[model samples]
Target: MTHDLLRLATAGSVDDGKSTLVGRLLYDTKSVLADQLDAVERVSRERGLDGADLALLTDGLRAEREQGITIDVAYRYFSTATRSYVLADTPGHVQYTRNMVTGASTAELALILVDARHGVVEQTRRHLAVTGLLGVRHVAVAVNKMDLVDWDRSRYDDIVADARALAARFDIEDVVAVPLSALLGDNVVERSAHTPWYDGPTLLEHLEAVPVGTDPATQPFRFPVQVVVRPQAGEYRDYRGYAGRITAGVVRVGDEVAVLPGGRTTRVVGIDLGRGDGTVTELSEAFAPQSVTLRLADDIDISRGDLLADPGRPGHVTRSVGGTVCVLSERPVRPRDRVLLRAGTRTVRAMVEEIIDQLDIDTVDYRRAPQELRLNDIGRVRVRLADDLPIDDYHELRRSGAFLLIDDADGATLAAGMADAPDRYAGADI
Candidate 1:
C-alpha cells in the first residue's frame, strides 16, 4: 500500500534558517540528485563559503539568491519510507505575510522555525496567529541553529516554553518543540550526540509518526461543479455528467443530494472515473479531493458554479456574509468598493458593506471600525454579494468556506478570505 501524504508549510523570520532547514531535510533524506548538489556546491565555493550552501537548494529564484532571502513560496516534494511529504517553503519577511497565508491555506501541519539565539519574535507570533486562523491543527516548533547557542538545554527549554504559551493562546493544542541545527544536520533526519540531553524524537521521526487526523471520507459531502460534460460526438452521446473534484466527504451512487442556490433535490444515478483517452469506468463511491464526473437520475438544471451537497446538512445560501480578510494588494479595501468574490469555481460581483475592524497582531485585539484595510492588514469585513451563494463556515469546511477577492477591473487578486472566526478568536478577549 502507498503511504499517506502529509502537507506542511515552513514559516519563520528572515535569517531564521528556513531555507537551510528545508535543504537539510532534502539533502539528508537523499532526495536531492547529484547534479543539483553539485550546482549548490559550485555556488557555495564561488561565494567563498566553507560548506555547500544548502539554502541554494530551495532559494531557486535569481532575485531570492541575490538578496540572500526567500521572496516567494517555494514548493518541494519528497518522501520517506513510511510517509510522503509536500513541503511549502514560505517566505519569512514580514511583508510576505500574504504569501505565508497562501501557503498555509491548505496545509495540515505548520513547521515554525525560531532562531535559538533570538527566541520568539513578533513575526513568530504573527505567523502562529495566522496558522491558527487557517485551521492548521498541528504545529512543530523547530528551534534551529542550536549549534550557534552551544546546544544548551536551558536555552532550548526556555524557547520551547515560550512557543507553547503562544500556541496555547491561539488554541493550538498539538505543538511539539525540537532543538536542531539545520546547517549541521543535527536532529533533523537523524539524532546527533551533540544533544545527548534531548530525549524526544528527531524532526523526521516526528513528521513520520504524527497522526493526520480522521479520513476526509467521514465528513459531509461537498462537490462544487466545475463543468458540465456533454460531448455530442462520442459513443456515449446521451451522457450528461457534472465534472468536478469532491472538496469534502464521500459521494456515492444512489445518494440523495441537493444543488445549492437553486435548492433542487436529485439522486446520483452513476459516477464516472473519466480517463483522458475517451474511456471511463463506473465507480461506486468517491471521496474528498478526487476528480470525477457525477450523473444524476433527473435532468435537473445544474451547471458550473453550482454546489452539490448532502440534503440533510446543506450549506448556507445568502447574499450577505461576514468574515475576515487578509488584504494582498497595494490598494486599500474600503466600504462601497466593488470587487469580484471567487469561491470554488464561482465568481460574482460583491460590495463591501462595512469594515468592522482591523486585527492588532500584537494584542490580538480588534481596532474598531477601521475606515479601510491596507496591504497585509487582516480585518473583519461584511460583504453583500450580487447573488446568493452556498457558502459554509471556514472552521467546519475549509475548502467550501474560503474565498478570494479579485479586482473586477484588472483581474488582480486582492485578498484571501475566510468565512468565520474559530471559537478561540470569537471571544471578547481575543
Candidate 2:
C-alpha cells in the first residue's frame, strides 16, 4: 500500500524545548542515522552531559549550535509503516517570527510547544495567531517539561485551556493537547508511566492518525497556464496545447472552461499526460494536482499567467483587494509603496493604498491604522492591482488565495498576503 504524506511545522517561545521535542520524536521513531547519532553522543560528552543532547540533532548551523537556539527553518523527513512525514522546525524567538510564517504557510498541522511553567507566553500566542491565519486545520499543543512540574495535571490543564481559547478566536476547529517531557522522552513516541490519568494518544500517534487533504473531485477546477506547448517538427506540427498542473477539482473532455484575465470561453477537446519518459498518456478526465496538457476547441490568445477554470466557479476578477499580510523583509511597507504581487502563475504591479491595522502580539488584538509594517509584523492592507486577477479567498482555495509582495527593484519577497472573500471587499476605496 502507498503511504500518505503529512506536512507539519513546529513553533514555540524561547526555552520552550521545541527543538528538543522534534529531536525526541525523530530519535524515538528511529529516524536518526547511526553516524548522526554518534556525532550527537560525542558532542554531548564534550558538554559533560550524561546522555545525547537531542536538541543537537536539529540545531545544525554552527551559529545555532554555539548559541543554543534555532535561528532559521530546519526541515526533517521521516516515514513510518503507514505514513510519511515532512517536518519544518522553525525558530522560536520573537525576532524570527517571519521564519515561523514561512514554515507554517504550507503546513497542514502545527505542533506548538509551551513551557509547562510559563503556560502561554506572548510568543506562544503569536505562533498560534500565525497558525490560524495560515489556515492550518489541525493543531497539536505539547506542554513540554512535564518532568519539571513533577507530572502535575493541573499545570497541563491550564495551558491547554489557554491554547484552546486563543485558537477559538482564530476559528481553528481541531485541537489536541499532550503533556510530554522532551528531555526524557515521555509521551512523544511511547507512552510514559508518569501520567496514568492521561489516556490520550502519544504525539506521534496523533500525527499519524490526523486527516489530511480533501477530495479533489468535490472542489472547483482551477488551472493556471504555465507554458504553451507546440512542437515545430512533430508529425502533428500544427497542434497547440496549454500545459499546467490542476490546482483544484477535476476536468474532462467537453467541459467548458473560462480563460481568465481575458474572459474567453473554450471547451476542453483533449487532455494529455506526460509520463516523463518521452511518452504521453491521453485521458478523458484528470483531477488536481496532476500536471497535464490541454487542447482547446478554438485558437484563442492564451499564454502564461492565464487561468483555465470551471466557468460556473471561476474566481473573482478584481482590481482592489483587501486581506491580511505578514511582513517578512527588513524594509517596512507603507502607503504608496509599489511592489510586485505574485499570485500563482501571474505577477502584477500593486500599490499599497492603506495600512488597516497591525496585530499586537502581546495583547492579541489589533492596533488600528499603524504607520508601517516592519519585519515579523502581521497587519491588514489594501492593494490596487494593475490588472484584473481571478482570485479566491484563502479559505476557498489555498493555492489561489495566497500571494506574495516582492521588491520591484530586486525581487526580494517583502510579505505574504492572504485574500479575503469578494464580499468582504465591497465598498472598498482603493
Superposed by TM-score, candidate 2 places the C-alpha of residue 97 at a distance from the truth, in angstroms, of 1.2
lDDT of 2 by residue, 90-208 (tens): 99999999998999988999999999998999998999999999999999999999999999998899999999999998889899999999999899998999999899999999998
Lowest summed lDDT window (length 10), candidate 1: 421-430
Would you list the C-alpha lDDT of every candidate in the order shown? 0.91, 0.92
Cα error of candidate 1 at position 119, Å: 1.0
Off by over 4 Å in 2: 425-430
lDDT of 2 at 412: 97
lDDT, candidate 1, 1-430, per-residue tens: 6589899999999999999999999998889999999999999999999999999999999999999999999889999887889999999998999999999998999999999999999899889988987889899999999999899999999999988998888789999988999999999988989999999999999999888755776788999999998856767689889999999989989999999989999999999997889789899999888899999999988889999999988878878877888999998999999999999988889999988888888886678888899988899888899998888898888999998889999999888999863332455532
